[model samples]
Target: MAGRIKDHLSIDCNDEGAYYVEARVNHPLREFLNHTDSSYVSQLLPAGATWTATTAGGYIAMIQVTTFACGGISLGAFLSHIIFDGPAATTFISSWAALTRKCGEEAGSPNFDASFVFPQSVAYPREATLSALFSPFLKKGICRSMRIVFDALAIDLLKVKTASSSVRDPTRVEVVSALLCKCIMATFKAKSGIQKSTLITHAVNLRQRAVPQFSKHSMGNFLCMAAALVRANKTGLDNLVCHLRKAIRKIDIDLITALQGDGGWLKYCECIKEIGKASHGTNDKIDLIVFSSWCNMGVYEIDFGWGKPTWVACAPKTKSKIEMVNMIFLMDSKMGNGIEAWVYLEEQHMAMLEQNQELLAFGILEQSPLNLIVS
Candidate 1:
């Protein structure tokens, strides 16, 4: 009976972000077997877990099981980016810890009915429509091989330097994004040797699309991105920041209102088609696609009566070729405030990033902890 799977449940924190937990028998590697009870499992979570909290949007956390030298007990949890975005994932993990401690409970029972919480039925159009929008761009084939790199201290330093500049506040998400955007733009320009107007499309979430007090806990992809134009000749960091801010701001209430109405989804599709047409098969119009470094891997609160996790990271399988740089942040260690970024890019562009090392710095991890542990 113990070996049988009991629950495969996903819970939304009080903040309305989603997380999943699964219980399984502990493997033979556990050393402290038969010593700890379920309550001990709960205590181990807060002590050993760490999270990379994002500033952009949702609550995201990555939980890792470092030492599982206990009984045959294990649990897993996942915080999806669609529901909590990035910022909310972090808040959910911290809040879950607080809630668990306050109740003096061992893994609080989760409210896991996605029908009521996410409600895929009434949320939007059918799956076909959503699939049409998200279908991978395979017409030309994936162009570049991707590699992920992380340089915690180096990225932080860049943030500090960019913040000191007069153009924009030195916030972690914005400044880092701006820097990465510039890096990619430079790489494309240097490699392709074509200088035309280009744009960096920033994916913006539309959670407050129609509903003002829209519950952050809603589980779905209520998100969209706006392209911030950058001239091929623009070289300065401030210019990138200014255009990014403007592009982000442009996707305001009017844009959301226009997109969410009846048949709005189709209109949105047409808009993308139009842009694709405008690009005219040239890298001039929108050369780079960039998103903030954020993901929610429920690391801190997933306690399955084992010791806390020692390492956690994003899955390496998640690769991109639309742009040279795609980044996501992870917690440095348990009980640490610093974050490490995993950047995916092509080898050629990566060399350029290294050449301009003063502007950007990164180190490749041996392997992605997420892929290692989860898969």
Candidate 2:
């Protein structure tokens, strides 16, 4: 069923289905998959079905299935960020596949209405300025996205490198994000010939953090931002991990309660303000790097009647979603223990980053999905 948007952001559930497309390509999937150029990946994704506040009654989800000459298929889905965050999108895909397989037990019924806890009025105030809310990192620019794979061995080494008395055991996401941030900071310094203060924001899932916690199956944008700052000189991995851990720890029960309160928007505004303040106060240029982890979201487990996907991927660099500079999206690799980071930056910095020995030591840059063996 399609969700029709009413005035004040209310959704009217109707029988109309989501936007879907199916196409056949004469070329085999291996031709594009094995190709060195990553642009071929975008051909499998559906386009021209985006949602905006003004686009009333627009479909909340868009799906495309492209079949190759070799009989291999590519299933691509694009969920509206308005109502679906990473976890919500994963749940939607999994449930859709379960229904296709006639597995009623695996299907999930998502809760579309979350207004009781997060009212529309406070969610987005008419007077709020988006520029101040996101500021430096929320602009369109020429970005180059590179796929970097960190095997389990690299992650274990990173954990050892980041370990300290304060943070005995750091997760894969933390160590990877820290190492990437360190490399990015170095890249910025090399480009500008001066060290710059960097602000790192990681997307935090609030579904399990909120008081009277919402179910994992609950829908809508249950996401919050956690900010960690790395000064120009203090670009150590341990320092970055410490700051990241502290900022993420701040998104506790109290913060979630405030986000769910009547003055929820105010609380959110304050959080953004705090982030802005934290990002400033330095004379040097501030570089904002955004990180979103889709690891352990069960995306690889999404199996239709055809069986599970051989490899899952984010959209190519041509997509506008990651056009903003310094965006890093981390996902669980096909092996389930490793991580694949989609790092987006400006072309020049990306060139330097791709050659960074420190980064390349821990990650394999632009690895082909076709050659990936999921054992």
Candidate 3:
């Protein structure tokens, strides 16, 4: 493998291994892998990704470019999650695109000094302890991913429905999250015949939440979780939004400083442990749903000299213990006006969630025209 071979390679090998496959498509790219059913795209990803082959680690990341007979092309990336979160990962992709066209500002160095936020006195909990607490979610659930699209009209209508004198008005992310929260709660209630206390957690970006906001170039995971607890009967969208808003507003610099340095882990562990033990007696189990919005993360804007991506998504093989905790990743739609929610749920509840009337009313996948061209 010579560096000069980067332009293109012609390899002659018997098709007995997994790294490459030369295949033919019998239909249009969109029809074969429809936008409405994005889950199908995840199934074909493992072979298409360039996996890290060894610890010698020559590649921190791998890129796969696939061409279809209908002239459609798809770009996929396999990034090390240990090193990059959603925003950081998108930054890398965008920088590559900018370099391809030579049209963007010079890239700046990333900030890795975490001491700028947390003091040496602050201590984080042991990773093993945190993992043990959430192990219950990882042990027995079968995870499934489903893509839900909310066009611009549906988003506006949700805002209208959620606006009221009693209920606090919400942002697109808030209202949408609240709507999904209720849908899941309703599904659980209908299945169990009893209401249960549940938690909703959203991953909030800490860069903008800081006192003197951190630069966008600052790297590493700078995310804090904002959580709200909703009791059995108060699972209404309005109630959820209100609780969620309060939780988010409470994530000030004081909370960030405390959570990072001042015995935060000890208190958090005790709280979660006590909640779990207390719930064992009431015949009501706790359900946690986590949402992370990547709405303006610039992932959809990666052009790479071919064209902007028609669809961008995280491959399912990248799924980890986090999915078992029930998570949703909300991304900006290709059109830039709506949201696309990639929801990962336990297999048993997926059917019920898809059929959720209120969710269906808002999230209906709309197909976009694809342009097929060359590099």
Best-matching candidate per TM-score? 2
Clashes of 3: 1
State, as a TM-score between 0 and 1, how close model 3 is to the true structure. 0.76
Model 3 misses residue 149 by how many Å?
A: 1.3
- Candidate 2 vs candidate 3: the lDDT winner is 2
Q: Model 3 residue 62 lDDT?
A: 52
By TM-score: ranked, best first: 2, 3, 1
Give the higher-lDDT candidate: 1 or 2: 2
Best by lDDT: 2
lDDT of 1 by residue, 1-375 (tens): 001111122223445422333333344433332222111333333222222222233334334333333434333334433344543444454446546556435332332232342333333444324333433211222233223333446456655565534554644445556666666667767887865565465556555444453444444445565666676677466666667767777767776667654556655666555444544445334454445444333454443234455443343322233322333333343333334444455656656765665443543333343432332
For each candidate in the order shown, give its overall lDDT on alpha carbons: 0.45, 0.80, 0.63
Candidate number with the higher lDDT (1 or 3): 3
- After superposition, which runs of candidate 1 have C-alpha atoms over 4 Å from their true positions? 1-128, 134-160, 163-167, 208-211, 270-286, 295-311, 318-339, 359-375
Q: What is the lDDT of residue 122 in candidate 3?
A: 29
- Write model 3 residue lDDT over 23-105, tens digit each, in one string: 44456676745444455565445353432222322233555556677877666665543345577777776776778778666
Listed per candidate, the RMSD to the true structure in angstroms reads: 10.6, 2.8, 7.9
| Candidate 1 CA-lDDT value | 0.45
